[model samples]
Target: MHGTALSGWLLVAVCTATGAYCLLRLRSDCARARSSAGGEAVMGFGMAAMAVPAAFAEPPSWLLAGYAGVFAAAALRAGWLARARENGGGHHLHHVIGSLAMVYMALAMSAPGGHTAHEGHPGAAGGVPLVTGALLVYYVGYVLTTGARLLPAAVTPRGGGTLAWRARPELTLACRLSMGIAMLAMLLAL
Candidate 1:
């Protein structure tokens, strides 16, 4: 969701591309990579759908409710995965937060007197301003941290050949950073 149609379309494209790349990451041999990629794929596609310009199609209330329900379930699943004694539990924990934020945003949009009128203004949605602000802060910090992690580093590449890019950790980090920035934009629109 954005003020302008062009920005909305851009967001959708970014998210869709990120989702497609994450789907490619599913071929990774590492279980943790596959699992995290699965969750990220869902988030990417979901964000794309939600970012559709209201001018083209204003989703019905029931659909918004469905979004809330689906993301809630995803949040629960992520919470469970986060508790497991796995090396990538941190990634699952981040997914939990991201899913819950999506749920919150969907609910906010579905609520009466929500973003129906002020489609692009911050705090226009029906959620508590503090909560929205908190999510915005979290996503901003996530974007910054992920972006920093993407800085040039001296290290041997793990994967090789034509298919190697699909499993590159740097690519995954870049994908996460893009999504984090998109999330920030969505929250600001809210």
Candidate 2:
């Protein structure tokens, strides 16, 4: 419990950095950077929220509700994008899962005592950290696998348009990895 706060703050930093990076990249002339801006921002914000006080304190009710609501909408949007075939199969799928995961974490964190890491903690959500554990495992695997892809020589491309960001596999993947790591930190605190 004592060490958890440090990790929690670290996660907060990670998420804040990611968010700032994504938003800043969006300003670049490269449309490739701008394309994923919205998604990355949302991921950053969600992870930041989940990381803070993940193991101990309850988030404000409005914050919990707002976080869940926004993510729920993102989930729905992901579902729609998937249906409309607007995004890549893997990326869109991640969005769908990530959005749902956010909602789950929000509600789980907002539970009686906001102690989801240890399901047995006071006000535990179902007294089972099954979802949290599953998300943790998923993020770990994703981060490892994605890191492997980064081992190859990579080049940032230039493009201008809404879809340009899709061309920058490195940035997009890095955003995903950072977000996954942030979520992992939060889950660990739970």
Candidate 3:
């Protein structure tokens, strides 16, 4: 990522932790929950790997291509999931967007004159400006909307007894919100 080393490390930590939590959600009794968590875990870990600071170790082009390939497949799977009648599909739609965004970033970074070519150029990152701008807008809106949804849940009391963190809808919302924020940050860096 095009940022201070500390910020890069912070992104890594947040993404890694989020991925771990998603893995825990795999234990959920709900089949849909397990499926969603598995996809989310992939996203979280992928973001963590991509967020590694350029200053520390610039990833090879082949690795970036691998990322693009992985995310492309993920996008396809998410799209299929979104079309399934039994699934709520709304969240899967978001996963589709997120996976495509990851593919975009990976491809952009792997381009010949990508991130490396723009060193020391303020506000000048690799990738098509229009595409990056659109992603930025999408992630920004996603973060805002998700945060709004989480607000009421934060203040409201629930009648049910305690549930596992993995089963708590509010925590899931919060996790999604955090990932949206992280995506926004990453788009900015791009």
Best by lDDT: 3
Q: What is the lDDT of residue 26 in candidate 2?
A: 71
> What is the TM-score of each predicted model, taking all chains together?
0.91, 0.76, 0.91
- Cα-based RMSD of candidate 3: 2.2
Q: Where is model 1 more than 4 Å wrong at Cα?
A: 118-126, 153-155, 159-163
lDDT of 1 by residue, 83-190 (tens): 885748898989999999999888888876565656565445647888888988888889989988898644346464344767687789999999999998888776
List the candidate 2 regions with Cα displacement exceeding 4 Å: 1-3, 27-35, 54-58, 116-127, 154-168
Give the runs in model 3 whose Cα sits over 4 Å from its true position: 119-124, 154-159
- Write the residue-wise lDDT of candidate 3 on 6-105 in tens digits: 9889999999998889998999988999989988999999999999998999999999999999999999999999998588598899999999999989
User: Cα deviation in Å at residue 102, candidate 3?
Assistant: 0.5
Cα lDDT listed for each candidate: 0.86, 0.68, 0.86
RMSD (Cα, Å) of model 1: 2.6
Q: What TM-score, to 2 decimals, does candidate 1 have?
A: 0.91
Candidate 2's TM-score reads 0.76
